[model samples]
Target: MTSPQPTPAPGRVGSAIGWSYVVTAGRIGSSVIVTFLLAKLLGPSEFGLLAMATVFILFAQTLIQQGLVAAIVQRDKLTAEHLDAAFVVLVLAGLGVGLLTAAVSPLWALINRAPDLTEVCLALSPLVLVQGLSIVPEAILRRELQFRSIAIRTLLASVLSGVVGLALALGGAGIWALVGQQLVNAVAGLVVLWLVCPWRPSRRPKLGAIRELWAFSAHAANAGLGSLISSKADILFTGIFFGPVATGIYRLAARLPDMLVDVTVRSIQQVSLSSLSRLQQDRARFAAHLVQLQHLGAVAGLPVLGVLAATARPLVEFLGPQWAGTEIPLQLLCVFGAVNVFGVLLGPALQAIGQPGKLAAILWSRGLLGVATLAAVGALITSDDPVGQATAVAVAGIAIQLTVNAASIWVTVHRVARASIGRFLAPTGPAVLAALAASLVPFATDRLGVDELGPLARLLVVGAAAGLVAAAVLWSTDRPLRQLVTPRLMRLRRTRAATGTPAGAHSVEASATRSTEK
Candidate 1:
């Protein structure tokens, strides 16, 4: 048995955040390249097939990877037995999930009336096992605050997998390019994780260890399952009703917002969960820290999503004419993404405070609401036009989701944590104002005849205008952010002067490697 480590120091926490952003940036860049290339090469039908198979992969991976790995991170104390037991459980779960997916692939395809998807699903089944193998190790790295290693693994895997996918696409491999990309990413990431992480699981599974972890992990898994259902419901409905082409269009529309959330919101959530969990026992610190993170999320995440929504038309047009129908849905989804920026923290905050059951309840409620609303929208919005149907459904779905997320945030911040609602929401005013002010830039550009420019040129000009406006507004109004940034800049300058050496990626990676080795 080992005693729990203390909370991470500010410097370590800062490094964790930096590396997390590095990983996020790398993934976003690679994803943008690979995704557009494949979309252009294979067209809508192929992507729709990939999306269908991915739905199953996402669900199954959540089952195997979410619960126990989260338990390991949230637990106050951990031992070799716990790690070993979690690893064994994940491995077994992965094997079972992969086999089940393979067996059910045909049935799923049959249900969807897409015979081609059967093979696609089968091809992607092994991802469950490959991805599962890395979960515990990845969790261990997170728990240890070894984000630099994780960053490296992530960047490397993304780049390599993007190359593979691109090469296959260029070779006219169709949807298999997408399929191969996922598998290679999972496998490459797993290999890098094993290489970087020092912990090796022994072949021992203890019932006691599993039970101790299950106390938290069960709820964590349930909450994750619910969240997944909520997130994936729109895709499910679109695919089933509108077929692959419509599904593909809707999927692309959702993709940018989803990627923005992943890059901004989820990355922050990952770092925050670890930090918040460490501060759980200190009430004042915990509450203050939570609110500050909310402020950060609003200031940082909201503006980016707003800009994306504002520039959605030009951005989607740049993708190709095949994506002509994506603009409205993308804009709607960006609004959902904005709501997520504010509400996403509620889950992690609850989880950190040892209220997994509460989080689970909130998420399940959201999931139910999401499903019901999406179903109603799907049924009510009868149209021969797929794009129109998708837009209608998106409007309805995003509206309901916004309400649910707002309520969830209220429960977590106002009711459970007993934080001041005004204080929790203080930053949002400036954030929304800034986001709105920034959004006007793209509209102004359009008014100035920027629409006559090429899609890429319009995107660049509009994106730049929005970004500059957002930055200026935030810099002017977000005092807390300014306060946070000034000190960091000062510290960096002082450190640079003291060392007379640049502190860059190589240095961060090297230091992290040394720390890992030691």
Candidate 2:
């Protein structure tokens, strides 16, 4: 048996999370600008065509990565041969998947009854190969906790790709503009990843080095595929039943909540896999970090989602009249996003503890349930109204999320991690309560004629009010959170003060005072 892995230092973990947040923040910011510009320049049918083609690309991506990233990061020992083997396997898989995607593009379009999607899929096929080349290198970076480099790659790619997409949109390239964005993003990321990741594949790479990794990666891949299918099932069903226009609208609505999760929950989840994997042998430390990360994720993520749900109408309105059908779905999805934040750590934590099979089983079960419920909704709802159909889909989605995700959390915390259910859930209670409290701020303000202020103004006022309310509630109820955030606040204050810049001294003092009360 191999020796236990060393636990990651707190500072290292914090830095990783910090950089990952930067990556996600930049990505979301660039994407929002690109999305807004493209929405005006293109129509629903155009976006729908791209969305239809992307489902296939996403599946191909799962096969190419095959959970090798987690396997690489979670492994107790590393070898040069392992990296070479993974790189070779993935590159070949990328080429094969790309070719296969191109070959099947026509058939996929026929199935969806959208002839335009054929060229779209063909255009995106090369992206499968381009992205595949970067997998092992990116994995290596994550394993080494080199998130700063990853952040740089992500930010640069998002901006450049967004620029390319917007330029094409402005030039009236329509759907191809969206297509170009995807291709550029993948290529840019691949180039930057190779530059930062110094390891290169050997000339005589051997598959034998991956034999051990396969045992881990196989289950990780299954878990990943299942999770992907579960998340994408609604869109797939929407595309199949409602066609491209509805699919485009639904996709855009779903993207908002998904982006919100990416901002904090998903970033923390990515860092948790690497950090938790390092602490696997230290059960006490592993448990501590696991719970702390979960608590922090909920504290930071759920409230934002809650505010989004409460203020979704104004948020969606900002996208213009073409996006009229988005508000209801966006609100429902925000709830799903909030619940999803709680479960984000489950897969990474399980994989880190060498229980990827458990994660796979849970995810697959959830996927099947999600698919079945969505199919039922599709069959029962005879409404030709794409917006109504999409709304029903969103409702079913959140219901599935609430049931499966809650149970999965209980299983991960109480059964696998050996913590009490209450201990696992206690941190989230304050967050949930705070979210409800924050949401009420919007409800009350809206009742008091906040709608008269216009969408943008209402959004700003509601967002600010909800955020402040959530922060106050969380600060009052959660002692550990105050302890966790106070030092960071103080450090920020000291930096700004020393630099002769303005800072929120009162907020820092309040947090500091609350932390001491613990």
Candidate 3:
């Protein structure tokens, strides 16, 4: 298979951004629908059981995938032999993980005291295999920045999974429905990746061809494992100490923030990973690009997370009374989400700069800190107040984790590119301030009885209003962010009229030209 090229044009980037918006919307919508259906079909107990199983499966998958697909996107040259070797590695790892999951299914079932989980685990095992096969092809597509195709594939997978899951639930399949949905989604995703992506695995494997790749992969795996442990330790503790009902409630509270994080951080990571990889040879240029990305993420991320944190109570109530206890946890988790924007952007930087070992070390440090925090919190809080304990654990862990992550990324950037912390944080400060200011309006509105509005109306009014206000505030306070994001918005009417393209597209064209020339 041939290596995928960079995005064809600035218009292509815009198009990809548009498609990403659509794909994100689709994923969020599907998640809300699925969650609602499952909540109604199965009570908190069963939902929590499924959530526990899923957390394990997802963490395991992340470990096995080893961030190599990300490595491939960051690497400049992708030979046929490299592709072949990566595919071989993925296949082997996938098969091994699948078999291991299958073998452990009975033991997990016994430990959890849920016989039904044995079937769920066994049925979901194929997902690892399917995902392993699809990783390289999906990476190739991402490298090409052909997110429209990816969006289409994702939509199909979501629909198939939703339909299959709902059907199974209607048929009284219990937790099997959730497991079936995930497996089916994996299969669909693999099929779509195969069909849309041009890469095909070769008949022969080239082990030696991927030595450097394996080194990167190993570091990435270690980092990913650390990240996984850090992120999931709270949930694991909840499952162990508080039982499935509490775990399920906590999961529900976390759902919205998690969805937003996935949509924003994950999408940006895809773009940054590919773009930064191309500029890796130039330390100065790469650092500039990294800062630009960090600023963009802040501009986009802070306002959204701020609003969610501010309105968590209303949001929980609107979702359902069953979700009422999730309000505080959601609010607390949003802090992590805000800090995570910085840490997540650094991942691509590390990959691009060929410093996966440093990334691994940072992740391990954060993970160890997170584990210690969780353990300490669990011991301190009584079992009668599991939610409070979980929240405390999450907040404490995230605080330490973010501190370590920020320091590590700062050190790496300064050492590698002679960058300073002030340069990195300056652009984001104004936007963060703007978002904070906008959040006050919503808090006041909630205090003044506007929150009594219907759920849908409240969401629309508060969300839309806060978004507009925050955008305006940022535009006024942060000239660079405004120029970087929507330069056309600041341009004179005459200039906009002179351009045939929308002022926005015109600005994008100009920016792209400048970028290319540089």
lDDT of 1 by residue, 1-518 (tens): 37986888766766776687678878987898788777777787788888888997888889887577678888878999988888888889899998998999999888777889899999899989986788889999888878889999999999999999999999989888888999899889999999999999885567467888888899999999988888888887777777787778778877877787777667767788888899888867787778877776677688888788778888878888877778888887777777777787888899888888888888888788888887887777668776787687678777877788778878888877778888888867778877888777876887899999998899989998898888889888877667656765677778888887675523443332222122
Query: What ranges in model 3 sit over 4 Å off?
Result: 1-22, 40-42, 109-116, 167-174, 485-518
RMSD of 1: 3.7
Cα lDDT tens digits for candidate 2, 245-292:
788888887887888889878878878888888767777767777877
- Candidate 1 runs further than 4 Å off: 486-518
How many clashes does each candidate structure show, in the order listed? 0, 0, 0
For all candidates in order, the CA lDDT equals 0.81, 0.83, 0.73
Candidate ranking (lDDT, best to worst)? 2, 1, 3
> In model 2, what lDDT does residue 277 have?
81
* Highest lDDT model number: 2
Q: How accurate locally is residue 438 in candidate 2, as Cα lDDT from 0 to 100?
A: 79
* Candidate 3 residue pairs that clash: none
- State the local distance difference test value for candidate 3: 0.73
**TM-score per candidate:** 0.93, 0.93, 0.88
- Model 1 residue 28 lDDT score: 88
**How do the candidates rank by TM-score, highest first?**
2, 1, 3
C-alpha positional error of residue 94 in candidate 1 after TM-score superposition, expressed in Å: 1.1
| Global Cα lDDT for candidate 1 | 0.81
Q: What is every candidate's alpha-carbon RMSD to the true fold?
A: 3.7, 3.4, 3.6
